[model samples]
Target: MNAVKIIAASPQEALEQVQAQVGPDAVILNVRKLPIDGMKKLWAKPQVEVLAAAPEQEPGEQESLRQLAVKVQQLEGELHARGVVPTETVPSPDAKLPPKVMQMIRAAQGDKLEEALLPAVQVLEQIGLLPSHARWLSAQSRNFLGATKPRNLPEEMELLREVLSEYWHQLARRLEKPGNPVRVLVGTPGSGKTTVLAKWATQETFLRQRPSRIWRLDADRPNTAEFLSLHGELLQVPVERVWDPDEQPPEDTLRLVDFPGVPADQP
Candidate 1:
């Protein structure tokens, strides 16, 4: 329920700032025309701006709006002094979790496992499972089987290991035949392309019998370069840099190219 103060030449300009920062749906809570001398001694005429609150009107929108509000509040004073306002929200801690998990956390229900949902989604997503599948996996993890006596530790560990092994084997089988690896693979932010690349490289190293060589065509980011470089060093694999596409790979070497998965804007 915080309010932001902004000074603009006109209400329209103030509304633009609100829309650009908080968006178009912001409710104009209050607006006032004020003398410039109140804060600054620079202008002869008065300035005006509309103050607005654009609370998220729907259950699904609350988290994002709350996050935006917090960020706007943090920068409000600085923005006022500098004559600018934030146009986007700071990233939220729960941003990577699925929307359903966010919704459940907002609900704050006794029956919901909101605390567990973030980690649950992360683990399942890392294991190459989709949201629908992960939802089922979370439910499975909650099984107590009526009243549970102290189970034999050894038997329980064995059962858990077997389940994990089968789960991964099924995941691995989903991959397209370890064919000639792609020239370049791209994915959006948070997509596990880099990890998948390392996993693929390690599999290739073991399967090829001969030492595997990695050639980096281009890294989408510094982090990607760091991960690949570290993995290559650990595996003692030779890595080459190819800045140009026309540059040829080493003779009889496996080449892996990583590209930034930039999504195309829709028309």
Candidate 2:
């Protein structure tokens, strides 16, 4: 699958360009208003940018396309670093990969890398990484080992920890800061939406010393309302069941709305 960004005078024009260039199977990823340029800001209207991605291809072709896309991205980065414009068209997915990239792909597919990294993979798996996540971590560990050899098991484990720590730090940094005055949690049944909301409320009230109000819109779940109320009482915060859609929370307080869990199939 391919992705591209297009800018036009309006959203409709941008979408028309996407459909023309990316084909009818392309899906719109995002649309945003682009900033008006210097002189254009005085008289011209702002442009709109649309990001779109092509539909998935067949399974056998999909893997090849993914690898090609990654190589293309790497090539683009190299070109950008050297202040050179990257070529417009990348090699087709069916085209043969370069020797070095082919070797890397082969090594990733082979059992030798997996065997060498099994201990680290096991360690990560034991620490709550899902099977897929463990495999991904193992692959990254293997790549790291290829570039720099570790002398012992302890060193290998340290490298694994470093990789995990870097990823954890990145994930934490990417988490949205609590900027919204009114936050809502909505998810499917048994999705732990209530638990997450309660935890956020706890952090706001006790950790940040900020007053918070909890509203339960899930009247169907009386038990959840009671659970939130119990915690509210302990936190000395007001918990209300939102019977009316237009009901507003108290002023100068962080408001958290707990929504009813909808069925996945329904939505």
Candidate 3:
């Protein structure tokens, strides 16, 4: 099931709206008052921000979701072990998916599809997507699943898988095209910064068919990961090591850098 964010004048109103749109099976995760800023705070009625999700339909999905939950817990433990707390994850400016992806986004923003988009949105949030990204993905998925409707739970799950595959393809095509010439990955320990850099670098050199270079540099502390260099050798891409503050990426060549194990407070 997907998660959705609902805003209303009161908690009761917000809960009622979530139940109405997402059905009574909706599970409320968080509810907080939204503060208005400046002079508007004086006149505005307090708004409630409620994060809720719909119940899953199938036993198989329940198991899969349980596995995902376990993994999330593991990652949380890892984060705490490193003294880091990440509040938000922002997507890249060119993060949009293609193959008619923008059209679906337009449809989702309309008030008419609000109800239809809630289920996808709710499920996405429960799985860790920010509400905005969840809404966008749900909107795209809703439009992607149009015309031919799913007849049953199994059919609906199958459609979801198909939609996911199509989105991945669009993402690969996005990487294959000439855009975002420089890519940088940053995060605390065990946050997949290195893994993310590897995937994107792979996409650039192999999938996108472009020349690329990997830079391993230290920011505040000494960088100590050999993963990128080994992977670069395997991928037949040039790998540069050591801390270089005055350096610039080679003219017109894609640059992938992995700066891991650095504390968030540092540069």
How far residue 124's Cα lies from its native spot in candidate 3, in Å, is 3.5
How many collisions per candidate? 0, 0, 7
Q: Tens digits of per-residue lDDT for model 2 on 1-267?
A: 567989888655675687689876555555566777689888988777777777667567557556655654554455457675312222233435687786676677664333333454554454566665666677677766334666644455566766777778889788757554567777788897876776677567655778888887654555454566655654578888755657665566898888878777773
Give candidate 2 regions above 4 Å deviation.
1-118, 123-131, 143-150, 181-203, 206-209, 217-222, 225-227, 234-236, 243-252, 257-267
Q: Which candidate is the best by TM-score?
A: 2
lDDT of 1 by residue, 1-267 (tens): 566667777655665576577654444445566755455666465666555565646645456556644544444444456664223222245457788886766567545333242232333344476655555454444452432332433333233334566668889789756545545567675576755665566556544644566665554444345556655654467666655568655555567765555554522
Displacement of the residue 185 alpha carbon in candidate 2, Å? 7.6
TM-score per candidate? 0.29, 0.38, 0.37
Q: Pick the winner on lDDT between candidates 1 and 3.
A: 3
In angstroms, give how far residue 110 of model 3 lies from its true place: 11
The Cα local distance difference test for each model comes to 0.53, 0.64, 0.64
| TM-score of predicted structure 3 | 0.37
